[model samples]
Target: MSKGQQWDVVSGVGITALAVAAARAVETGRPDALIEDPYARGFVGAARAPVKLPTTPAEAEAADGRGYWAQVSTYIAVRTRAFDDYFRQAAEAGVTQAVLLASGLDTRAFRLPWPERTVVYEIDQPLVLDFKLTVLREHGATAGGVHRPVGADLREDWPAALEAAGFDRARPTAWLAEGLLPYLPSEAEESLFHEIHRLSAPGSRLAVEAIGNIPGALADTAANGSVRTLGVDLADLIHTGQRPAPADRLTNLGWNVRTVPATETAAEHGRPLSPAFVERDARYVFADRPPRAIASSAMSSVIRPPV
Candidate 1:
């Protein structure tokens, strides 16, 4: 795999999932998990990802630095569960529309017990989507029903492509920006939200996994600054670029926000968070519309699931 393809970003999640797999391994002593996802381990092993250490220990360590891969495992588990909860809540609230932005190798549609008429739209790079679909078919995994896979770069004009693929943005939408925004430049991050806000309707809900606090925050020393000072680096294993805005940027954009620390999110999921997972506040936002609007591409376009 090349360094910076959309597929490459998929690796971070893979590592996190594989960490979860390790947890699963510790729990069940099974190579095959109910997530039954052999892919997580296979991908890491095939590419030798875990073995590829960063050049400088500090740079590698300074990065997402999953040196504490075990700790990261807890985070991935929490995030995946949180998003799933958001999806279930949205469904219970009678909102049938859900769009996962930058939806890498996500298999939620296949795993979750979605309500009837629920549609899960996954958008990601063509190559990444292709790899996942091929693997999924080989694993005998089908989305069951009402799943739309739109292959496109989120940085480009994906809204048009999404509409063409049958997304109904005017209705209530449960939107997710998971494992994405931090990869974008600060401006690009803003643009991404503006685009989302543009598309959302009155009852729409939005959730984000944003970097806020970290354990090192309370340290009297300044290694990477404070716990809040360091956020997720865009690159995994390798240090690439930086997206410097704090997690609070979302609030500035006129959306209601909720901040949840790793500890709180862990407790919500009924898990004991490791110390590494603690020491900082991450955000899980819920933003609704003002019951008024300027036109957005999603608002004007009428779409239904391409079941």
Candidate 2:
């Protein structure tokens, strides 16, 4: 990863955000949609995309004539639903503070029925957040709760920036890291979780969409030709290599962790994913920090006093 690379809403990794938004727009138009993101189409429409992006299911099918967007759209829809349910569960459990790491064009702050007095912090690049806010404001959209946009690179000192934005480390928070892990180098991914653990209070919750391995299509020239046609090389955007597993890391850090295969989640939602996507061993990881007493006891057991 570059030390200080930057991108806007239509270039580099920023384009990937637009792609996801397009998928969300398609999903929202589905009659059997699991999640409704009304503003997703607006983001896709406002962007000057390098390639024509589909904002409806028919358009998605036509664009997938090469059989790329179909699987990707389904996978993105399933993933979005899973994370939406995660946040809803977190809210129902009375964890009000929420943080979306690398939050790109996500409309959750405006869409989700967050409890009263909830505060949602979105952390991402300055330009990315600025673009999102600009478009949402044009549509006359307002967040359901307190929305704090922390414009800081994830590889840098985002924790301090988040705190400066009125993030309370003492209160339990619901954190989401969707479509973000693969973009970070292995070491940086580790550092991200460590910082999150440090900043989290007891009873904090986390949801991560972890990519277990490089997708086969990206590694195959012929198979990935369809992707390149879209004018963005995902392989170039992501860091590929072995990394610390998020579930294992959080478990060792004293949080109760559960791992669910993406395929299983898709199956549960009655939306089967293509093997091209699931063959990668992608999964969702949910973890919860125990209460203060239980966490302290668990830490003490893991770390004994010096003799």
Highest lDDT, which number? 2
Q: Write model 2 residue lDDT over 36-151, tens digit each, in one string.
A: 99899999889898888899998988875765676777889999999999999999999989999999999999999998799999998898999999999999999988999999
RMSD of 2: 3.9
| Candidate 2 deviant stretches above 4 angstroms | 215-217, 220-222, 226-229, 294-307
Work out the TM-score per prediction. Answer: 0.69, 0.93
lDDT of 1 by residue, 1-307 (tens): 2324455323543332223333322222223212233344333233334333222224334545444433444556677667777787888888887888877667777767778688888887776667667766777776744889898766678889888989887887888887665455555566778787778877787888765542242231134322222222213322124454434555676666666665777786566566544654555665655555656767557665576
Let me know the TM-score candidate 2 reaches against the reference structure: 0.93
What are the runs in model 1 whose C-alpha is more than 4 Å off? Answer: 1-67, 213-253, 290-307
Q: lDDT of each model, Cα atoms only? A: 0.58, 0.87
